[model samples]
Target chain A: MSGATPMLELRGLRKSFGDEVVLDGIDLSVASGEVLVVLGPSGCGKSTLLRCAVGLEPLDSGEVLVDGNLISATARDASLRQRVGMVFQSYDLFPNRTVLGNVTLSPMVVQHRSRSDAEEQAHSLLDRVGLWDKRDSYPSTLSGGQRQRVAICRALAMRPEVLLLDEVTAALDPEMVREVLDVVIDLADGGLTMMIVTHEMRFAEAVADRVVMLDQGHIAETSDDPPAFFRDPATPRARAFLSTFDYRRRSGRASGSLTKE
Target chain B: MGGAEILFQGETISRLLSGLMVTIRISLVSVAISIPVGVVVGIAMSSRHLLVRAVLRAILEFVRVMPQLVLLYVVFFGSATAFGLDLSGEAASVIVFSLWGAAELGDLVRGALASIPPIQYDSAYVLGLSRMQTFVHIILPQALARLMPPTMNLVSRMVKTTSLCMLIGVVELIRVGQQIIDFNRFQYPTGALWVYLAIFVMYFLVCWPLSIASRRLERRWAA
Candidate 1:
């Protein structure tokens, strides 16, 4: 009955979409203030793992616990999604919203925070993401980086126990990628628990306190020091991924260019 | 009022302006009702239930495939006679037009919602938003942005369709023009052409700004 335990725990998580088995039995946990990075190639189930963890996708089997409340179980009772926040690869900004409006929408609407209070919090978060200048501008008007940054603020405004970042920077350009990762790294510095699914080995190596390597829907290996993990992968899948990634890596390695139309 | 001078000369101009007003009235009501109705239907179409989707699909296809005039006659006259309902010409046109608007706008809404990349939805889920939160704050806004241009274009079509209400004996602008020209056949037998031209221009006037807005939005959002 610890009040301040780890924010999330995934035990034997399994999921499938129709006939596609997207997540096999997986086990993972995140302390309230830890930053865990999930790495894998495309279609390897990293994104699916994040979605299942946050209750976005129903799990075929196993349990997803957030702040010790069950989000999904073996019986498929998904109910703990309220405290886990997520950021997607595409930012998922409200196109009908100004940057500030997007940031504060949930708080003012769902949480019933007073408009002034929500605006106050929104402005502060927008300032944190360096988007205050664009607060009045719509998502359709901002650059990719700016919009994604607004998305991050939108996540932080909810005061979630855990934040799930699914390749957020994978859609940004090189320079813009740094801008977003920097925000995430700063959040880590401020003790936000984050489970990030990403391909940015450099960012992973630089920011992750624990690096989890997923391969074909299973956790192949996990290590405490990301630099060590990236430099010396333990599992064959990790080594293979590392080996392949090093040969033809893109220059600048930013996320904005990654989500090219 | 404006185009009659350009398209036709002499004493036939007064009748056309009156006809123009009818076109504007029908379009305004139909367009207003269509917006919210289409949004709800579009969202319903994305529902998971097979029965709901099947019913909505049937309604949409029925509206889409059948001619609007036919729908008008059926919903207006056929249903009214069978159910013993009272509907004036204007009332029938508005009711029929709303249904037509619902089907068309619903599809436009579906496309608008579809245009949003899936990544955005992923973001909302990860942000701990409940399904309703995601729809209101995230999905609805993005959908609304994409919905604007198409709905505007739809307003133009709705405006044009009001001319068809002449068959229903609505005293809208086109009917007014036809009635006037029918009475004043001695002015010129060509008065029918003049009257129709004027009615068309009034529709153009009412729907022109909407078309311009639609074009501007399309250009701004073009890939």
Candidate 2:
């Protein structure tokens, strides 16, 4: 991991909202084509970490590097943004545009792709996510699952080097969650670089090349083998977090099964 | 009241109809000028910088609180007295209404911009849009959709507000109606009521459709 240059790197990242520390001084890196899944309870700053990585949130004092180059948060760097695509939990598709329009927007506007080429890429991506039929549809007309898929297509259409998904399935219905997770699994299988923030243990286990459990704005545990992490977490905090899920699963209260695919 | 009487009412009706045309022309031109200026002001108000937003808000507040008639008077008189600019009543009415319309629509646009969820901005940022691209491609399109109802409502109000231009002696529908009444006060006796009724009907015919359109837009947005 140290020999190869990281595709994405965060060094000494720190963020705060008023006096409440959301992300303490932290360092994280992801190698090329690696899937790093971040896991934590709410308020653990997993989402903030992703946000800061993409320059959506200004860091208090830190640096973010993409493929060994620093990116300025204030500068209007179209290429810098084009390299790091993100999909939100809310599926924030531009409601004013059609599905094709939403997906092709960045490619045409930022990358300066010709309309024909952008639409070509958009069509392929949409087809991959099984949303080709909904190409002309507005976001409001789609199901939760379908909209999330379109959101994924919109990000992938930019052809970024690294993709960040912040709890993409958190807003979906239980039945809808599988379709989105399946897309992530397919992306991971295709060897796309991804950093995902999610609470779905089974999906994370299936897709993550490495799993890091965040606690109180800090990395409490990291495991290269997600299965081992679930079976037996080394850190007490990781164990405690897993145990709550375990208890929930044993009592048949967990909405979805925790079995590894 | 009927088609024959309406069409054959002669010069009094003809003059009033011509005034109606002037009113329509002013209202349309005012809307065209106001909406774009209003959108600019609205976007300025939505700036992330507190200082910029505050300054624009102060100016918009002044415009909002001041009466349109007073603004007309100020622009009509002040330009002449202070700058020695002899602005015609039509030009003065345009300036005053455009200012007022821009401020009202600007506030509406500001509200629409504010109403957009923060996630939209984040999404646009991640997709690699520059600030301007985000606004043009993402923010403005969505905001414009949500802004339609309020904007149309303001346009109708601006149409009605054009009547205030009569105070400055521009020959719009209201002004022409008053002239017709004065001309016919003794000869026709009850002609004043007819002229007033015609003005009322004209204003209603112009504004009622816009109100309906505004409501329709609101319902579509809700859907």
Candidate 3:
């Protein structure tokens, strides 16, 4: 543990799926209300680390603290998970639910809020994500971009201290990626503390306060000057990663090496 | 007695209606009893534990492959001989139908549960939803939506399958139709045919809306 006591902190976090090590001795700290972005090659343990920090995976060894409170430190993940929120790549909204229903579900179910209040909060979140017009629409009825946005609203409805985004816009079409990123940028501007795993170098450069590039389950580089990192990467892996950013394909199809085919 | 009236006359109509009610009663009761059982059993079959899953899968498969008529006979006749306790024809029908419905419904539930993306589970945990919260708020809703169409289809089939209960003397619509035919054997040769056609129309009316609902729901799923 550091003397400074960051809002979100990890110390020697280690995780493995069977024999394959997803994260090995990883460590980082984000100050209160920091917008941090993590970038890495495909399957380089970025998502796994996010999962561990958010309590989705049981860490083999290490400690995770949220606002100086223990969340997942080998024995007590179930208690600490409530303070963190995460958005998925596929926008895992309850398909049976409308946009409002997706956002209101946890508050209504876990927080035991009245339906009217939950729906009211849900509607405000939908409005924030610019999907208030589509609140009654089922997730299947919405466009990919809209669904991802609704997913964001669903997470935001939890009022979490730290929000985690894992390739949220990757599932979107190229043209629609901007709309989702624009919403994220808006959130960042509002000083929402976030840890985003993203491939959108341009968006990350614009919005993120700091960027961490991981290779083989280790932080290869960390830079606050996003433009400098893009222009002159300190590490070879970071250069290889940034070079893949293509501004050409209009559909956000990820013209890079990690094209989700 | 009359030229147009047969030996049974309109007797078949009244008996058939009574029988249809009995059949519907059995199906509804059985299905109500079966839903929870099927869901739990199917989940056990799909469980991560090898021994538990093996046992559940073996039993479900054995039951599924066995003939319903045979099971009905066992429940109707075997229970009487073994326990010296006899159930009424309708009660027997309900029990047998429940067993069948549970097996089928459980399979439907299991399939629905399995179809959910693993990522959804990951999302639930990451969102800080507790275990119970995930099941109630996340797993159940998604499974219910996935299972509805198939379960509705099975219910229609179950309604139609009640005809088989006549073999056990349950006095369902088919049994009533049979009794009327026996009485009017000499009067009208094809009276049975018209009665059957009426029954077919009634079944169609009962099932058509459910079928339509299932299809619409499926289309919505794709959307």
Q: Whose lDDT is greatest here?
A: 2
Candidate 3 docks with a DockQ of 0.61
Alpha-carbon TM-score of each model against the true structure: 0.83, 0.90, 0.90
Candidate 1 wrong stretches, greater than 4 Å = A1-4, A18-21, A74-80, A248-261, B1-12, B32-36, B72-87, B179-197, B217-223
lDDT of 1 by residue, A80-193 (tens): 444778888875787767788887877876677898999899888888878888889878788788878888888888778888888988878888998889999999999999
**For residues A1-261, could you state the per-residue lDDT of candidate 3 as single tens digits?**
136668788889998888988788999988777899999989899988888888777889998889888774543444466578889888688877788888887777767789999989987888888889998888877888998998888888878888899999988899999999999999988888899999888888888888899888889899987888878989888887877774555775655677566
Task: Provide the lowest-lDDT 10-residue window in model 1 chain B.
Answer: B1-10
Per-residue lDDT of model 3, residues B32-114, tens digit only: 99888888876776678999877767777766788888888888888899998788877887887788888788778888888
Question: iRMS values in order, in angstroms?
Answer: 3.5, 1.0, 1.9
Global local distance difference test of model 1 = 0.79
Model 1 docking category: acceptable
Query: What ranking of all candidate models by DockQ puts the best one first?
Result: 2, 3, 1
lDDT of each: 0.79, 0.88, 0.81
lDDT of 2 by residue, A1-261 (tens): 858889999899999999999889878999998999999988999999999999889889888889999987555387898899899999699999999999999999988989999999988898899999999988988999999999999999999999999999999999999999999999988989999999898888889999999999899998999889988999999998877776443665567668866
For every candidate in turn, the CA RMSD to the true structure comes to: 6.5, 5.3, 5.5
- Please give the lDDT score at residue A86 for candidate 3: 89
Model 3 CA lDDT for position A8: 86
TM-score of chain A of 1: 0.89
Instruction: Please state the CAPRI-style docking class of candidate 3.
Output: medium
